[model samples]
Target: MVDILRADARVGNKTYTSATVVIIGAGISGMCMAIDLIKRNNCHNFVILEKSSGVGGTWHDNKYPGCCCDVASILYSYSFEQYPKWSREYPGQEELLKYLIHVAEKYGLYKYIRFNSEAKEARWDEEEKKWRISVEVSGDKDSQFASSYILNSDFLASAVGQLNVPREPDIPGLKDFQGRMMHSARWDWTYNFENKRIAIIGNGATSAQIVPEVAKVASHLTVYQRTPNWVMPRLDTAVSPLQQALLTYVPPLRMRKRSLAMDFRESFYAAVSDAKSDFAQQIREWCVEGLRTQLANKPELWEKLTPNYSPGCKRLIISDDIYPALARENVDLETRRISRITETGIQIEGGTSQEYDLIVLATGFKTVEFMYPIQIYGSNGRPLSDIWKEGASAYHGVTVEDLPNFGMFYGPNTNLGHNSIILMIEAQSRYLNAILGEVLRARAKGKTLSVRPNPDALKRYNRELQEVLAKSSFADSNCSSWYKTEEGKITNNWSGTVVDYQRNLSQVRWSDYVVEGSAKGVVEPRKITHLGRVREESYMSNGSLILTAASVLAVVGGVLLRGSSLLRSR
Candidate 1:
């Protein structure tokens, strides 16, 4: 058997001196990537640069009223770190944020992260085979760092997701609205809505959540909806203490729990993928039943609220009792077109004016705008914006053409519709680790590493992705959604199941890349380090023993079957 200490020391020798990887975001994806790198790849020379002082990514950023996840709480977390202690099925923002922080702490990932540092630009240096990243500290006036502070690794991973930019509607006289106005992404808590007339723009997830919370105290709530969404009943429940204790004591039990959650989530993939099927019919019936029960008093409201487009075209809203909130006497759901905004309120298409004390624009994020505000220059000084001027295309939604030694997490078409993105992040980290492993091997042999996907491969992959998306629910044009760009291109979501993505990334195709380095090199001897070896050995030994016991039990079952047959013959 290979000496585990020597192997780890060898791996550490390749990773200790320089950062082999730099993850740009300290969100869930970034944190997962770091854990995978350290535990699986034995890589310690990576850094996570977060623009904010803390982690949690979107959960950390958006703290608007009634903000929570649309995805079920059970399926929203890392599969390996299942939290059975959730207070609600669709956990509130603060709870989700706390979960992320807990994960970071458990993994001891705080040391690998730098807060309040934003990546300005990343340029690939052809000669050095390293990325030249420009980062600026938020409060520093002139503190800038070139490539002077990076690990010696040749790979760059951008976990800075596409949905970070807040999208402001190009409404006429939006800036002139004298009443305090703010985007859902940048919620202003100081502007009190208590006993105030509030007009909320957009009936998406944010609007749905905010409406109920604001309606509780607001004098009157007016919801401006250009298109009505298909809101479904959310079967949310709090996790009991007994369940939490079981998860904490027996980690393997959580795997069984996650499997059940995944099974339910996978059913939605089929419903969304084939919108014309029976599943879609069932969803329509559910929506109609919900409408009939909630808007029974006003049949006219039901007709206006019914969606003409397919259920999957846009994001499906989840609510335990949103219809009841809308039916309240103080709540008003207007399906009118906005003509313009006045100083104190809004003017509708029929020239009707509605007054309000505050306006909240839950317009969603600028998802189509990938890596905005940051200018990226690849080899030959070619800008990424110029390359993807028409539309963005990436190899496995991680690597791009002409952008050597750079990998991105949650890149084009990698967003999921059915499962937690933590699965995708783990898969990507494995794929990236394979490539980096080869790079280190080549370096030890005195060769430089260069990995790029074939043009034909990337073209075919993206073509299939777009084709699948065209048939999916997000492509329905009856209602405009953030999923599509200005040109009507579906550039945000992954069109297939998480399993498909995982299987595709299971192995790296060497033929798809071009590696450069000296053919001959010498391995440097280094001091032995046994970090995490004892824990790793304990787990591995237990797993091996379990497999051995299972094999023996299977043999015993066969022998017992044979003896039963002999007894029956006698």
Candidate 2:
């Protein structure tokens, strides 16, 4: 392993200066990319610029009262490093955040991360074959160091993730609200909800989690439901001391347990993809039963909350105890549409006033707006905003046609409907590492290398994605979701299983790229040499002959040894 300090010293040199790869966000994706680049590819000329002071990205930011992962804790973690010691099946936000921090520390990713350093804009410089990035430090408010920081790197990986910015609804009199108001992503811990009248804005995953938690302590909790989601039972359980001890001692047992969890999660994708399947019907029935049992008295409320669209149209909310929380006397689920916000309360469409001391908007995130609040200009001096004006897209959700040597982790159409995102992240990082390997080989041979996806190929890939998405529950128009953009395009989700994505990116197509170098200098093709083939051939021809010769020599040697032993005894 190369010393990170030595690696930093080696950077900015004549040969290694051009090899630096800049990663925008220090989220799960960014950290995963860094791990792959350094440990696997041995490319230490990289820097991760994170706006936040710490890691965990979304997990770090959103720390609401009852914030937790909907996905099973085992499946949510990295496949390579399975954590068999989860406190619950569905781990809380703090636990998940700690896990991410552990992963970062274990990989020594902190040295590569520059906290509070935000990339304001990145422009591709065609003449220099590098990206001119303009970054700003948060504390430097004087604007004295406004000069662009030139990063002469061969590649740019935007792992900034899709869900950085929070999306607030356009209410008529939102600014007029006199009481304290804040988004769930930006939770205000200073404001005490104890004995205070609280009003939650949206009834999505975040709201579902927050309402149940704050309702226990709040004077009054009113949940404003825009559109009710299909909520399912979360069979969460605490990890027993016995199980924890077994995991610590028996490694194979933990591996088996993780595989079992993975298999169970992957089975859900079939139901998500095909709404007409038996598995899908079973899930729907369970959801219906849950609603019927919970809201037995208030059938009207149950009917209003029940979704008309398919199960996976929007994200499925997991809560075995959310309905019980709402059933409590202190909790109230308001299905009425908000007409406007008053000076000290909210006004319903039916001329009703619901006053609250505090209002929390669990309104989710602005997912469609990729890399928002930052300008990205590609080749030909065209802004990324203008390029993807219609909708954000990338070749294989990693590379774009015109954007040479630029890669995106968890980019458009890469979000999985099933399985762990860590699995996807590992696969993407490996693919990017392969591309970087090719770039380094080209550089070593004193050649210039540029790689981009073919426009036609990209078109076909995206067309197939759109087609699958249309058939899936995400395209269901009855419910409005963050998965769909303004124009009703599903740009944020993968329409298939995680295994399919892994297979697709298993190998990088070198022919899809363009290479430039000295006219006289011959360049080696970037391809994986099949050492397995040579090994197989050698085994087939020489194996039997070599074994026979060895057997005869062994017999002769044994006879000689026996004769020598008999002579010594006599």
> TM-score for every candidate vs. truth?
0.85, 0.87
Clashes of 2: 0
Per-residue alpha-carbon lDDT of candidate 1 for residues 97-122, written as tens digits (9 for 90 to 100): 99999999999889888788787888
- The deviation in Å at residue 432 for candidate 1 is 1.8
Alpha-carbon deviation at 248 in model 2, angstroms = 2.4
When summed lDDT is taken over every stretch of 10 residues in candidate 1, the lowest stretch is 528-537
Candidate 2: tens digits of C-alpha lDDT, residues 52-80: 88999989899999999888776687766
Best by lDDT: 2
